[model samples]
Target: MRPLAILGDNITTDHLSPSNAILASSAAGEYLTKMGVPEEDFNSYATHRGDHLTAQRATFANPKLFNEMVKENGQIKQGSLARIEPEGKVTRMWEAIETYMNRKQPLIVIAGADYGQGSSRDWAAKGVRLAGVEAIVAEGFERIHRTNLVGMGVLPLEFKPGVNRHSLALDGTELFDVVGEIKPGADLALVVTRQNGEKLDVAVTCRLDTADEVHVYQAGGVLQRFAQDFLAQ
Candidate 1:
């Protein structure tokens, strides 16, 4: 079980992950360096997919690192900070996920309303999936971004009306425990426990709306799902 890593309401994909065109020699660059990717061609964080170095570099390469970033040591800081582990230093977000992706760790993200509300970029989903994010639980979601998550084999969940992160007291520091199989409109319990020993249980509804979504997710992605279906027939 991984902590849900909650965020405040109205977090767009651009905020969830960095989107600008410029890539600085920050945490993302450091990961790129480890992966042998030159810092000059780092490009946007979006372009790093299929390459570990680029993705890790861009994890914190956001030119405009949101002020909402909550550091691992329980301190939220502006801009990117290097996540230091026994494996050396890596971008914070990527560092959290690198452990999981390589070891096949199960992960989840918790957020407030309007999650994934931004450009309908597939990389938004790809990034999290590559990082081993199995699911996202938020107060709400944008239509396209939700689909994008499903397309990438990541689950998107919504908090019930009148129930939100505020009431749950989630501060992006709690480890979340999600139960049940992914199904359209399925009910699941999000178990969150804070560092101070506080516990929060949030009710969530699965956002995948169609059987087609299940197919895409089960096949690991839209293209793979399509290819399988096309080849079968």
Candidate 2:
């Protein structure tokens, strides 16, 4: 996996999936319009989350998102923007996700402090997984969101004390290797190799804080585990 995007601190659940009024220019709104839903009928993302088609479009749909990859005239532009690595195309967040999905690429999101600090919602976890994100390495994580990620089978890792995205010098131009085994409260190594052959190992803590969380993650999320158990019985 590689760094899909580098995000800042305090990235809340709403940033991952906005629940406010949907605007015509928003991804969810545009998707609804294309599906023949009238402008006035388009609802908030929180309402249509049951429908994955419309909900997935809301991934990273936050208008206030500040993706470092998006640049204009040598300045970091705001909004739901993403920079596709290697090819280096700066485009809308969803478009970049679409490209990665089509390429069958795996993704890893690197974030700053208090990652996933807002409302507790599974869509925040589901949306990123649907985008093909395999894991996330952040400076820190909100407690519940960490569990939610595990429930969704999305690996949640944390940078060791005093370490962060900036300290790693990750510029979204590297391949990441999550090296080591999975265990509750385990310290893992995130091997990052840069484009110039520079490599470094960053120590990260596994966010599967409990044994049950580990089991759930191993079974590919809560529902999958339940299904497996049910079939066995």
Candidate 3:
């Protein structure tokens, strides 16, 4: 899977799904305008989240986002921005997600310690899963958010001690594959293939943490697991 976004420590739910005013220039705001909604009526994302069209655009919509993949003069560029791989085009986070979605590409996010550390919001997990993020490999995770990710069928893998995105020198120009079986706290291999064809196998700890969580994740999330059981009954 490709790295959709490489983020740093303390990436809160607010960063994943912003609750602030939607500016007219944002992807969600632009979408609302196309739908003929008056700029004055363009509400906060939290208010219009029931509409997937608007909500999906809010993924990584925080203006304060600092995406490592997006850089300007060797400094990490801030804002809700991302770099489309291979092409290396830097665009708003939603535009990049839209492009990958249209391509039907599976994505992954690489993050630092305390990833998803804030108010527990379902939208934080839902938004990434909807964007085709199959997994997230981070230095560490917030407890509630980690469970939420499992509920959404997104694998949460933790780096082994002293191993992190920075140590690996990941510049978002690489592809990743999860090698080996997954189970609670199992060591899984994260196969990193650089743009120049170099490969490295790094071990990551599966954060499933419980047999029940594994069952739910393997069944493709909470709703799917419920449906499967219901039909079986």
Best by TM-score: 3
> Can you write out model 2's per-residue Cα lDDT over 152-228, one digit (the tens) per residue?
89999999888987887677888998888899989999999999998898889999888998899999999999999
Model 1 quality (TM-score): 0.76
Quote each prediction's TM-score: 0.76, 0.96, 0.98
**Candidate 3, position 47, lDDT:** 92
> What is candidate 2's CA lDDT for residue 94?
88
Give candidate 1's whole-model lDDT. Answer: 0.67
Task: Say which candidate scores most in lDDT.
Answer: 3
Model 3 deviation from the true structure expressed as Cα RMSD, one decimal place: 0.7
lDDT of 1 at 25: 47
Cα displacement (Å) at residue 173, model 1:
5.2
TM-score of 2: 0.96
CA displacement after TM-score superposition, residue 151 of candidate 1 (Å): 0.2
The ten-residue window of minimal lDDT in model 2 covers 67-76
The better candidate by lDDT, 1 or 2, is 2
